[model samples]
Target: MKNISLRAGRFLTLGLVLTGLGLGSCKKDDTTTVYGNWTQDASISAPRSESVSFVINNVAYVGTGRNPAALSTNNVYGDFYALDPSKTGSGWSSVTPMPAAAGVRYGAAAFAINNKGYVCGGYGYVGTSTNITYLSDVWEFDPATSTGSTVGSWRKVANSLPTPLSGAVAGSIGNVGFVGCGFDGTGNTNIFYQFDGTTWRTLTNTYPGQPRSGAMSFVVNNQLYVVGGTNNNVATTDVYAYSTTSGWALKHYLRNVSNSTESYDYSAVSRSLGVGFTVNDKGYIAVGGSTLTTCYEYNYADDTWTLKNPFNGSARNNAVAFGIGNYGYVGLGYTGATRLNDFYRFAPNDAQQ
Candidate 1:
């Protein structure tokens, strides 16, 4: 062989190229997969949705939902249950009910503030007729005492929004709670309001997604994400986010898939229903209808949507979900013509890629 001279920089460049290609190949082989499906952690003796759920100190408390009639009359259930996922024994046990039966309401909202849970808004039978009364009232529940008292009842706080509205999405970041985008009985709304324990103030800026009702919302990394809901039962895949300074920005559109079957009908016949929770800066949405057993997740860093494993329970919609640390709980809803009172939990290994 003839004598060959090699440049030092050229040799380093060749080494880097080979290393990069090898890493890229490894990443390409790492396909995303669903690790955990739904598991029956604890079954409530009674089932309810359109009710409220919140977690404090790794314990989940669920209460309130409509009865089987699909009518608000006799729909209110005051009884509550406490679930300890860490325990191996019977998961959920009965706790105190609300002092009085809450309004016969469905599609209400709930959040925890100062270790206390607050429940607000939903349809109820104030009279004999079904009315979309958005409750301005708020109730406080203490997990330590295992009791709830209506302390922060719907008082007119400073700069309160127009009229009481229901089907609105509510969530909290830090000490502030946000309520945005829903119906006022007659029409969809794009208004945004914030509550700081004592008062409510409307943000001048509004979200970009089409005004909708029954959408699900959660906060991660101090940013709020709102996903999937209906405009007259017209489900939408549009997702939006709000930050401290950046009011609202369109993130991505959710897509539905059936075991690798992809579809872009986010606004198809699916009903604008409820079921969402936050996990490790990501938000997961579960169960909504006109159809059931559907699930999806939103990644905040990339602003991308990924269809996850479908719920393994009865296919249904109009249910609610809450996250306690890494565990997710889903329960209660109308499954086509019938109403269901069952609940399930989803646990995924956060360490695995």
Candidate 2:
């Protein structure tokens, strides 16, 4: 929370003159676009924010964050639950609770690789008090064999992150998981790291954008993209994409689809602490705008964005979201006044209202 890290990206003030150059922009036409419906899903066991979530073989695993404790706000726990998108009423069941070390950390980054689920580096409190600790530990959860609510299956795999971090994001591309940008307690970081299921290492190149945490991250077509986080409390629209073929590049700027001139005035995606997920080849981002109710879909192939169905639940931030088969599920977040347990399922091809 130092002013120094927050000041790192100070140059991105409004109209700071960023452009697409060779990047092609897509403008949405009313006739060509239809939004999906956000139907309610089974509520989670707890209402929380800063939780970590990812999908493994179409089953979504959501776990680890604090529930409200009196007026204190943070009551961190490490329980994980499995939700099968195909199962309706009793859709959720308990998995092993994360170890005391892993479950208590909030703002940790998460991803699914092969058949294993990983949660890495987050913010946690010490000894049940508000004393803050930045964690860089990496944990692996294998649901293929884990049972009950017993803390048994999770095992720490690496030494720790290069540095203690919170609010960074992790996504798998091929067999490797990539982690990027988070508050290191002293400052926000644009630094990046990679985990190969057993070890953690740093990527040679640095992120081209400002250092930030709480950004939305998901994978598409075997590539990873990180977007939309606050820097020094100001929401950013910059997106930095990374892959083996290309390092970090400012591929395309987020502009309003209604503005053909690449005007910032037309975009509504500039918020932080929202949830993001990938469905097939495209990525859907929702519920992170400053006061969010709108949603958008990103077509990375054309470098274009189209507005999709907005979230139907009460507007919330820091919610956990993930994709299962053809649909995306989002839920469990804070609404500023209340921590929420309501879950919603988004079907992108359904008839629009």
Winning model by TM-score:
2
Q: TM-scores of all models? A: 0.77, 0.84
- Off-target runs (Cα >4 Å) in candidate 2 are 1-33, 69-74, 101-103, 126-130, 147-152, 256-266
The TM-score between candidate 2 and the true structure equals 0.84
Off by over 4 Å in 1: 1-32, 70-72, 125-134, 146-162, 255-271, 350-353
Kindly list the per-residue Cα lDDT of model 1 for residues 318-348, writing each as its tens digit: 7767787677788777776666767777764
> Model 2: which residue pairs collide?
78-103, 256-266, 256-267
The worst-scoring run of ten residues by lDDT in candidate 1 lies at 1-10
Q: For model 1, how big is the CA root-mean-square deviation?
A: 10.0
* Per-residue alpha-carbon lDDT of candidate 2 for residues 186-305, written as tens digits (9 for 90 to 100): 999988888887777889877788887769987887778888887898767788788878787775555443243443332466668887788878887889764787777777886656
Q: Look at candidate 2 and tell me the lDDT of residue 192.
A: 89
Residue-pair clashes, model 1:
0
